[model samples]
Target chain A: MDEAAVSSLAARLADAGITRLGRSLAVRHVDAGSCGGCEISLAGAVALRAGLTRYGITLVDDPREADVLLITGVVTTTMADAVTRTLGAMAPPRFVVAVGDCAVDGGVFKGAPTVLGGAERIVPVDLLIAGCPPSPGRIIAGLVALLEANAAPVAAARRSSRIEPHA
Target chain B: MNPALDVAIASAAPPGTAVMLDAATWRSLAAGDARLGFVGLFVSGGRVHALFTDGSAPLLLATELIANAYPSIATGFPQAAWFERLAFDQTGATAEGATDRRPAIAQGAAGTDAAWPRFIETAGEGFYQIGAGPVAGRIASPVHRRFSMGRFSMGRFSMGCFSTDDTRILRLEHRLGYAHRGIAGLMRGKSPRVAARFAARIAGDATVAHAVAFARAAEAASGAVAPPRAVALRAIMVAVERMTADLAALAAAVAAAGDARFATLLGQAREQSAVALGEAFGHRLMMDIVVPGGLALDLRGDAVASLLAALDRASLVVRAFAWGRVRRDLGPAAGIAQARARSIRALAASVRADLAVVPEGIIAAALPAGTGTALGAAESARGMVYHWIDLLDGQIRDCVAIDPSARLLPALEAGVVGLDPQAAAVLIACYGLSVGAIDG
Candidate 1:
């Protein structure tokens, strides 16, 4: 709803890109507390425009095998632990991409008692795609821009200085 | 209505509202009426309202509660178990003799696992427990399931995990409601037009069904009938949405059956249908397509043409695949029984049948002003969806949406027991349960 705030988040996310890493990236998708709307877009974006596999993005079943975690929905009180555990399970050089308006800032359900706001409240987010449910093309563009941001140095530093997973 | 219920309903009901029956009569009808199917159970105004459909006619029955406690009728209608707990969570009401009393949707304090309830451990030897998801892989909705298993078979299955070490098979507890957005609560005091948006978002995949249901409820409450053209267009939209959802459900089933080739074909069909929906409607999910007394957007001829063409392509794929030939072959391992597969096949066939029947044009009537209470039901992909609305002074007083998933999810949990995790996931997908829909 706040266009200025969303644009700033997008601008911030554009600062991180995987320039030095290999082309292929293993991704683990976690639904923290989605209504399943964002998932339709995620699947559609990957299938129609991006051809995720063609872009060297492979979805894996295990979090341990993933380089990037694409999290959808707002982090509910019930699902906050799963989000924390999932982010923690990912190895170094890992990144978190928050998809949909809910994950960005809790969307229309912002003040709901059950929700813990957005993905940022639970974990550090690298990118935020803002839409009630973002269109497939917009999702692909956001992801591509994220790849081009190239925050490799920061990722490397964060890996060496890692303490607790949530921090 | 049954003879006894007709008398009670006629005597106790006020004007257009639901009938208020005494506790004795309510329990008797709930247990004795063999043809009565439970529609929904909710708490409103210090009373537990039970909705049911007797054959083609829908009936709403209510029983007053004292001190927030009423006698449990779950023994008569097994489905009332969850509704009772939901009633408790929302209004501090309880079914006096109900079996399960855990909190259904009440969120605990932040940072604590207080929201999750523990499973009752059974008595047996060498039984181990496995917990899967409030968050898991691939599934879009979060569901937590705790399974007690032996070396070779599943011992007991529950939804939320707690520390328990019992050896026998206990009840399987399922933890849902993580996606509750307070749609019903949010709709209160809003105009029908404003409330329709919230209803449409109840379950994104079933947006059309929910929108239509809500519109129907609003129209009924206001004593306004939508134009025939609007109704036809609404029917067309519902059919298209159902076709797309069925294809996706089939894709999940086929993939579970290890037929990657067939799954890809179905997936492509679903994708094309979605694209066509976006072309025709403003939104891919077709959100907010229906309004209080009519349809929102008038359909363009080209939009209808593209949607029909897409449906035809999907029908051709379904025929070429010979869906009925493989219907009998599906089993629990594939997450669908032969019966369910047969029904899904029939759904695909219905989509084919719908291709020839298209709405002539898109037209809608203006909303009328009135105040009353009424119920509406629409056939969703899963099953029937019912919506009841009470309007006073042109504003919503109370509303309840009865999603088909609410009735089927418990059965799904019970049926998937003693199976491997992969099989369980497949079964869960086949049910096409929407957590958001149920919570609403």
Candidate 2:
């Protein structure tokens, strides 16, 4: 809310080397068939609120540029390929980050024959975040944590998701 | 009256193709002074734009009117088919003459009363009917569902993935999933957080769009405003999602056209964007970045600097491509084979009455035929999305959401109405529909 807080946030992120300059990351966003609710939240992060571009990190249009695949919603039978094809397009050193519980583990769409939960069933997920669609701040926190883990020494473990298995 | 309005009214004609209705006449014809049948009469720059209004209550009756009149609107708007189908799915309404009755979502066993994608012309069972095999199930691999009505079959390879027999070439037709998740039923009694994830199920890319809209709805009711910082962050997130999806759509087009090099480049672009998303926002897709009345996070200072830096890098990337060459110039431009970009406003307003449902990005819409409450929208990526949320004492009584993908699937079948199947798929992709958006 205040300029001073924003300034400090920037300093801290830079100290962590999370800006676009030092980071070479790729993102692949998947829609697991959400109600557009999570997307709207994501929209706020990009459009109305925190601009990811200012961080020097941006969303790669092509899968090849993606270092991370951002997944959302509950995976559906229909969308499976689009997700796979998107992943297939990416190069190595890719990370799949399941943003919501649906992608992490199929939320409501889980168990349904038509519903496919968690993006992992399609590709290997590097990280998983909690919440229906985590708050933009939470989303950023999750991403920052991933970046931090990715930035850590090879031996350092990444942030494992806290979501429980499908009920 | 503004001269532009008059000019738009006078010129209310589509270039190259004969517009079905003139702007002024259309406004007058569609005028529901009471905002009863439909409210806003939005037309952009001579072209008939989109219309919107605050719908009334007792939606079932209003929904029924639109259902019965969908086919008629199709005669004029052609796009209303999707809306009609959506109306049917959300409220059990239907267009009297609408051929397709494929249910988008259902409560009981899948396909018991499942609606077809849009009715296709078939005498008996001769028509190609592709049933999306269960992606997961006790009897079958439900997650790897396939669609095979006859000789045509669609399959999934892995984690909710779709795959086809290598030998089987692509053919365009109305496809259906053997399984349907009763998401609405699930959200029926859950708290917002429990039901919040279901919103993402509406459409993947539009997850933020829908969430923000819902949050705005909640916020509006609560009379709260998001922090400026949060709003800024959300906007950037949305742009990233849009750009990522746009690139994917472009890549899909290139791949469809057998342009591997361009496709690869576009794919790379999408990945690059995704990676940026992951690094900046804790989640790559940035889902759930919004909260009711404010953003879930703050993106300022270094994030801004970093974002600006990335934009600078992207400038090089965006400029690297010869858009003129890659863009096939379709959708109005497609007809001329010229590169004429459709503004978001135009694209947003492209809602057709004949459409079985509304395309995505519609936060709220007025019901057709001056009926009750009906809100429509298209999520960020998965395609056009429609939502009709009913609140009783400020509690969600019923919420109906339809991803553009579902609406587009039927349209895709219709798209092949008089064109090459392959070409149509690419063209349809431009409208922005991802299967996840449909199923979600």
Candidate 3:
């Protein structure tokens, strides 16, 4: 698919109340000890040609302002607390997305003394994108899926809130 | 052999074969020779080994440690400072008389205190300190920098903020090892093929280069020769990897200099090249393609054509970016950007040349079962990457992958002195310092 088509599709999904925080999603990327391959792919995913920003998805540097915590790599012991602190700093209704095989289950680095398994070992991961280093297309698709999965909770909360006054 | 050094050849193989030398002789040689450049230092099997290259071939010098300590070589070779610290951290072997005997990788471990790495204090009037990162702005590998600032200058730009009295950076010190993943420990007891995966991931950006180097090291240790076609393909992969890395570095430099349009153009070109590489080699970074004996898999049927086309497009984009359009006062970043542009152009041409001459033969050769020690070197995008492998019955007994970032870190510490914080950040990006590779 073309860049325009991908952006339009993501926008359409966002407009359907995919996130609790309206149409836009702010993502904070955490490199909890990675090989840096995922960071390169993530850069490509958000590059000008990819046009992910047009879909109201943007990368933020601060965790407090982020709606999604996108983490890459196995959570090293040195970074495990940092990852927890970053997640703790974020506001409620935040989703944690594990971006690579290493973050998913520590991949090849599993059982190494320095690593603390995966992202789930420190913070609860809402979504898992699997690849040694996932492709840019796959990463984008995973984000879209995260948004879609998030919509169900928002819809259920809306329904319950609307029925509360009558009940 | 230099006749001035007392060394006995333990094994007669390649030039990089480990030669046994006493601690006294090793110290004397390091102190005497100005021509020999210290490449790396590692501790294995109760001995400290130092690798040196005298311009043409590498020389591996080994010495038995006395009381878990060796005489300091860092006094002669400043680059050996970090390596000595790392060796101490990995093993308890200390470099006695070394000036900076601080922990390198161990400080980044779980039990280490926050106040472990004590930065040199510059206490005086108008002298202050500013600490940046373990987490930086945008996507970056984690590393902390403690900048000692002194001598304030009025009305200077620092990280997009105008300061009333911006302090000149007197010194810049880096605290690395935040990305340590126990890569050397992970490779222990594994076959070269399995260990190759660890080497490939040491620094993801230099995966192809690292993999090729590790493969060559394993081949040398096992007495196996890659077929002609595999050798040709390896050269092509290295050129492509270099081209991609150069493009990324150039884009970063341009972005730092506020040329967003040109940076975006370079990014687009890099993305196109990555796509072509992914289609051709099954990974965008081309990881795991180069194994111990040879390539794990041959190139795709039409890889050459697709890659050539992508290179042509990349070259066009690079050539079209007007050099004169860039601002001259972008400090160090501008100079590095121009250099990267030239490097990218040359790498593209080299890739084209390499792709045009891929030979026809088997893609891999079976490595013979034996015990041997050898050093393999490959020119990465940053600099020379060396892998020292000791194989025992086809298993990696002792292995050390020395990344160029180890050397670059010291150079970066030296280069950033007297520059503004903003310029230092740009210089760091342009240097392409990989903390993961260094820690590994």
The candidate maximizing DockQ is: 3
Docking class of 1: acceptable
What's the CA error at residue B249 for candidate 2, in Å? 1.0
Ranking by TM-score: 3, 1, 2
> Which of candidates 1 and 3 is the stronger one according to lDDT?
3
In angstroms, give how far residue B152 of model 3 lies from its true place.
6.7
List where candidate 3 sits over 4 angstroms from the true fold.
A1-19, A148-167, B1-3, B6-13, B29-32, B108-115, B152-166, B325-329
CA deviation > 4 Å runs, candidate 1: A1-19, A46-50, A148-167, B1-3, B9-17, B29-32, B109-111, B151-172, B322-329, B333-362
- DockQ of model 3, rounded to 2 decimals: 0.56
lDDT of each residue in A99-148, candidate 1, tens digit only = 99889998766777667888999899877788867876676766655454
lDDT of 1 by residue, B150-214 (tens): 43423245423434442332335677767766778878888888888778877777888988988
- Best-matching candidate per lDDT: 3
Give a tens-digit lDDT track for model 3, residues B218-284: 9998999999999999998988888888888777777776777777788878888888998898888
The residue-by-residue lDDT of candidate 2 on B257-339, one tens digit each, is 56656555555545455445656665556666565555554442344334444444333444565656655433321431211
Off by over 4 Å in 2: A1-105, A108-167, B1-77, B93-172, B177-179, B191-194, B313-315, B323-388, B402-411
* DockQ of every predicted complex: 0.36, 0.11, 0.56
TM-score of 1: 0.85
